[model samples]
Target chain A: MTVGILFDMTKCIGCGACADACKEQNKLPGPVEEVTTAYTWTTVEAREGQYVRHLCMHCLVPTCASVCPVAALHKTPEGPVVYDADKCMGCRYCMMACPFDVPKYQWDRAIPIIGKCIMCTSRVKQGEATACATACPAEATVFGSRADMLKEAKERIRKEPDKYIDHVYGLKEAGGTGVLMISGVPFEKMGLKAKLTDEPPAMRTWQVLSNIPDFVAVWGVFLYGVHWITARRDTVAHHEAARKGPDTIDTTHTGRPS
Target chain B: MNSTATLPAGRFRLGFWTTVFALLTIPFLAITFLRFSKGLGAVTNLSDKFPWGLWIGFDLLCGVGLAAGAFTLTAVVHLFNLKRFEPIVRPTILTGFLGYIFVILALMFDLGQPWRIWHTIIYWNPHSVMFEVGWCVMLYTTVLSLEFAPVVLERFGFHAPVRMIHRLITPLVIAGVILSTLHQSSLGTLYLIVPSKLHPLWYSQLLPLFFYISAIGAGIGMVILESYMSKRAFGRHLEMDLLEPLARAMVVALGIYGLMRIQVIVRNGSYADVLNLTYEGKMFLLEFVLGVLLPVGLLAFRKLRTSPTWLVVGAFSAVLGFVVNRLNVSVTGMERASGIRYVPSVMEVIVSVTLIGIGMAAFALAVRYLKIFPEEKPAEEPEPEGS
Candidate 1:
């Protein structure tokens, strides 16, 4: 029942019509302020003779959800990385964790919150597709359950190997993003990062985290021992100095046995 | 701590409202207003590509790292009973307190919804590194306050509470030291999320170790700088006799940090990157040479280490080097794949400037009013020969 987008990049026309239709349906302010205020849930990035749609992939294992300290950004069971402004503390760590940089900040507001495509969950729940998918003149932006989309993508690639690159992004990257893509060219040439591991982003930190308790205990004992040894030595030095007359020990004497 | 000097007839030559503080506050106030009114964007030039700007890099990261001196010295003096270093404990703590307070301020401004800061504590995401950092920082700040409370009690002549606190100081100090170690290393762990984005030379599972070592080195350097500044500004004597031995310790720390830095680079198989010598390579070399190698070289020489002027110079170099290192990690090292570059706007600079200036002003006022430095007991009149 988890919904997602399956963008077939080979079918996209660099026309920016999807962007326009997205703004119109969402009642966005339009591209005039896309750099700041325009809410183009989907926009076309023309890179190296190919067009790519930049939007939330709605990962199956969302790094943004895991890293968010306040649970402001979350992944719904129905399959969307949803934003809750009330919960957002505005730390923006989620922005850093997202490989796609899909989340946008409403930086112009005095108390801004994160803004991102939520898979248009409201419309989709009513049995309609996302505005970008519905408005795509070329039917390039396909919508369905991720499982069905993945199956369809494999069929298309097998049916026409020459027409598609031998890759499906978001299948396993950052732990299997919901939105999948197929293109005619290499991903790197299409302005997408190549070679990211399929493992969850937070997986990188697990090693350090797993050993933290051990490190803390070992370091604690070592430091405590140093404190004890130094204290004992200082006590002995103090006693020996006390036995002698005043001024028996000097600064140079303390420098020894280091 | 107590002051032997009688109250001065007048204030310092350059008082709190000096031209520097005044000039600095203009930017600070302007930036503060804009930041609150227009959100962080109006003040900073940060974007989704570069979420953390200079404040997080400089103030919270580098500032807290340098301030590690307080607990390190506290552990050495109070816990280890090093009488020679006793003169430094209070001043070290004061510096640490001021530095940490400023870090919190910087963090507040950097956050988009400053109000949601409490959500970290209330919501409780125990699995996250940031959660650990947030909890540890808050707890440590509390511990620092408790550890520092005896000073205030002493100042106010609250003997009963002071005695109770003195008895508990050892356990409190141990707790503070433990918390500081966890959070300082956790700060470095924040970058583990961006393994690919962080320059390979700086990225490692050993990041926490590298951060801990460099923080110790930076903390020592900060103490030396503070010592030098106090001598120059307040006519206090330079603690060359104590600082000389400390310089040797600094050398040891720097040596280890340098070795670890190189080791991590090799272990990560980034040796070729340094040898190839691209822009990142040159900067990497610059951090290694100026921040690390030079200070280690200078401090390793016994004669140079003991010299007051040379020790101060080496300490300054080490402090700047650490600052550069932190900036490299938090800002310069990030891979902005979207080709986005951030140069903090004027307002952003102003806000950051204000925080530092206000911090310095606060430090100066505390030193003036509170017993920060140990009292210099005057020479007693020579007793009668037969008495």
Candidate 2:
């Protein structure tokens, strides 16, 4: 159904209620704070009294999913990019691949795994909104289908053109993320840095690696051809030397006819 | 058989490097214990922001690149039938085999769940760049072993298998070359997904090409450096005839790499903001100049390329600069997006050096026991047929 989130930064009240609800709902051990971690999946970054809640952007073609060796991080059909700790071999490549720097890690443990918002996949599957979205004191965080959220985001921007910046944060960044954000202030001013190509990063890898099979065939044939040609010449040279008398041909150390 | 064949001639010499190596290894063993027992957090400075460190950068990336001489020289001698270069084929293959082993060993420490590394084979995420690199490395390591098997088999008098390997040698080397090319470039593909995170100076569509070309240069440099060290340590006479042509070839390789790098940087027009002095700019300049331009210049001249001392100097510079290049790509290249710098811990340094020490010791052991160098005969008239 392509479920997604529409975070209206203008409506946010800079309260820690959403963060607290995320901690409670996810059963996270540590208290919620400005920075996220293994325990904290969501947090609010406040700049000049303007609040921007930080969590996974849940990209359409997630770089983390493409970079993972074991396919631990996967994007559900409904839209959340979820991580499986059981399948995770602790490469931490997802942590590096995320453009928004979303995924956090359990660096304190003997065996570490990454942490990030999964958009409450279990609850969302059961037709319930995310913990953070539901606990919002105001209608700042809205959960709906991606098409609906995108329509609402564009409508809000069009209705009050002067009141809002003429940009949707996740609409095109990193190849169109599932979560959309509209802010009164410029998104970058709220410390939400996400300047990237509209195309997914996975395409960048494939652009080069896709040529491998063709290269293998071409290179293999070229090498064999050279081997055959040189071997034939060496054989013919040996035959020519063998035709001469034993006293005439000097072939010691050559492993050829004497 | 002489004692030198059975054991290293200076078995009990216990030189200063030996003592230094021992000192580093003892602490490294202790650190490895803490790393496994207490976790990576106890010994490494790695965090969520900096997941990979010295182990992946130096040990895996640079280690693999430096060992490129194996496939490169093997193809030259076997596929192209360059008979003059035959003496170095085995040594390069041995170096390549040892380098992959070291990479696997380093991964045991870096992987979060080292035991599940094999899970990639079964899970099969073809979309993942790591998946492709993983399969290529595993397959290539196998190919390298088979390519090297004849040497070991011949040493131990296993003739039947040696003959079998001889028949299989051409195909084995071809497979090795293909696999090497795939993973070497795929290693660069790992960083392609981080275009936003990596500095534009290092990130580009042509990263794989740059990686493959630089690997060829690095491989040539490593062979030169290794040959010099072996000659110095084992008292084997240098093969001037072979090295002179090798130096000429290295110059061409480095020149090609440098040209491509310049074209990429100019096309990106990304690092043009060099007026504002930054650490990234400095590192970029260092890597480009010393690693590419300086070495190319050194080996271009006929006089310098022919002289063993000058050739070795150029090779050493290229190797050291290429090592820094890998570090720059992995760690320094991401400094802007990360907004944090990662310096290796003392324990990390100790472990890396100790691993290198172990690899060198293994190489030395092989050289002493195996027929690594061509047998040297005294320059004299042939013995009488009666004798």
**lDDT of the candidates, in the order given:** 0.77, 0.83
Error of 2 at A167 (Å): 1.0
Lowest lDDT 10-residue stretch of candidate 1 chain B: B378-387
Q: What TM-score describes the B chain of model 2? A: 0.94
- Residues A135-253, model 2: lDDT tens digits: 99798898999999999999998999987889999999989888999988888788777678899988898786677779899989988998888777676666677786456563432
B1-387, model 1: which lDDT tens digit per residue? Answer: 222433242666866456777878766776778789878777788876788878888888887898899888888776676667988877788888888888889888988877778888778665567877777778888887777777778878988987887888777788788888888888888888776577787778778878888898889999999988766556566667778878787888889999988888888787777899865677688778767888998889988887777788899988988988888788767744446655677776777777877877776666677777777655422112211
Worst window of 10 by summed lDDT in candidate 2 chain B: B378-387
Interface alpha-carbon RMSD, every candidate: 2.4, 2.3
Q: Model 2 chain A: which ten-residue window has the lowest total lDDT?
A: A249-258
Index of the highest-DockQ prediction: 2
Q: Could you tell me which residue pairs clash in candidate 2?
A: none
Q: Worst ten-residue run, lDDT, model 1 chain A? A: A249-258
In angstroms, the error of model 1 at B118 is 1.6
Clashes of 1: 0
Alpha carbon lDDT of residue B21, candidate 2? 91
